[model samples]
Target: MFSTSIRFSADCVDDHVWLGDLEAAENTFMLDKLNITHILTILDYKPVYNKDDKRIRLYIEAEDIGSYDLLSSFETCYHFIENAVQNNHNILIHCQAGISRSATIVAMYFMKKYTLTHEEAIEKLSNKRCYHMVCPNNGFQSQLQLYHQMNYAVDKTHELYKDFQSERLRTNYGLEKSDKITKTEKEIIDDTDRFPIKSEEKTLETEEVEYQCKTCQHKLFTRNDLFYHQQGRGKSDWSTKPLELDETICDKQVFTYYTDWMIDVFDSNVGDIHCISCQTKLGEYSLDGKKCECGHWVMPAFHFDQNQIERHNEMNHNHVEKS
Candidate 1:
């Protein structure tokens, strides 16, 4: 006997209702095998809601549901799935063989769940579900694309602020300024400068170094000043390699070494951070130290194993040549 909550009455409309059948039994068995705890059926199409425990709830259509009609309010539907995932509910959403209506809901749900672009979520869902069905003239995909674009814009702005702060700190510490340091100071800061410093009476040269503008050849007072001149706020898209974290290090030092924003961009590759602009080599000086030659700021070059670094260099070299 089918419960009213999980059965359909044929006397009403087109006699579309479920009876004890092999296909229904097979579908139930498939759900069981997958360990699906619940199923929600929409439209007046009634199927047995045979589910494990009380975790599953089914809602039959109270009225005619159309492809163009919103299942729930657009905002409510988006938030409902988002909150369900946040609360750790493993929901397997379906509707009528997992195509059309169900696909629409699930497609939107995936976008909200994983914070993925509409195209990305749709592609993934299509791959997972052979149904791969999408409703034509659906605005959900376009709306989700707008969301992704907005997030990308915000991230870029935040990165710009962080880069500005790093430059300020470098300037304050005289790293980008004050080239009048003694030979001893020079040795302390950078040990690899091949040119020998000539100074009389142990006094460093107080004269400022002149830097010509790359674009206009305009004489600038300092290399640091020319840094501002060389800058025109162009975007730098560089490839990154991930590195292992030294968990033994103090948390404060680790935090200081890495920025909160960079941690996300750094994936599992090997430690190699190249300048997105000029492809010049980069290293971590301070939290504020990793500025590139193209005047774009970047995170420190994470040192991975030698083999890993070599692989990354090879990959980067290929990428640069391709571009």
Candidate 2:
């Protein structure tokens, strides 16, 4: 059934914020009765209603697909919502069916305003609109978890943003992952595998831990240059699925943020990773980043294949004090 029902937040007795579908949003009687001052529209296209009506509407273009990034749009919507909340004005966040897209925004807003976890926020929202069944898709759910991990602010350096950007660009350039775009791959052969490791790069940070080529056991990065993500900490990057899964389902990979030795690769924005010792092709990285089998992303990605390299124990490395 199409739910035109305009549901109020279960927690707020003042009835300042509301959730519903396009039908409810367009109803003049409801708006007049509730005194709605602002409408935050989350849809791929704009909507036109009565010609005589004039009300403030903020439109955000988005889709309901799990991979569709609504996390990036949260702050803008929240800012508009915050103004209304402070001024004691009514605001409605709505999408086509008032299911995934608008519901996700409202869920996130509640999470921020109340300092609640994703699960807690969803439970609270569902308490009010249980008939609507407010459940964000797995991707959106994962992003909400990430939002909590990041303390409710967008972390651009996070890998997921990189993956999202990569996916979006691929769509824009007609080259999403499904297209299997691999035009700039460097022709690396076993004979040409050995590249000279600069002495300056090697000795720069002796005290920090690093990853090593598992095969030859030679140090990969001079120090632990692992791009620390909030990933593998809370739940998992962009995944709300069961942790135990088939091997084919989750291909775990790692990424190192840009470092001094990688300045050349960053120039072109895409390149392959090779062991400095044996020159074996370990993995590949891109400024645009390769998305993981799980939905996580990283940008300026400097990830190495887990099969080719091993992480050096941080406990074994010494900390160097800067002079």
When superposed on Cα atoms, how far off is each prediction in RMSD? 19.2, 15.0
Task: Give one digit per residue, the lDDT tens place, for model 2 in 1-323.
Answer: 12334543222312588887777777766676678878888998878756766767899988787766687777888898888879888888888888778878888888998899999888888887866767788878887888888788776666655555555444433332222212221122111211222212322232334577888987766333444332222235434553433322122456554443332222134678776568787778775665554444565466777768764544564433323
Q: Can you tell me which runs of candidate 1 are displaced by over 4 Å?
A: 1-26, 44-53, 58-67, 74-89, 130-323
What is the overall TM-score of model 2 with all chains considered together?
0.51
- Candidate 2 backbone collisions, by pair: 159-297, 159-298, 160-297, 209-224
lDDT of 1: 0.36
| lDDT (Cα, tens digit) per residue for candidate 1, span 173-277 | 332333355454354324321111221222122323332223343322231211111121334433342322231211111111232333323322233333333
Determine which window of 10 residues in candidate 2 has minimal summed lDDT: 185-194
The estimated TM-scores of all candidates read 0.30, 0.51
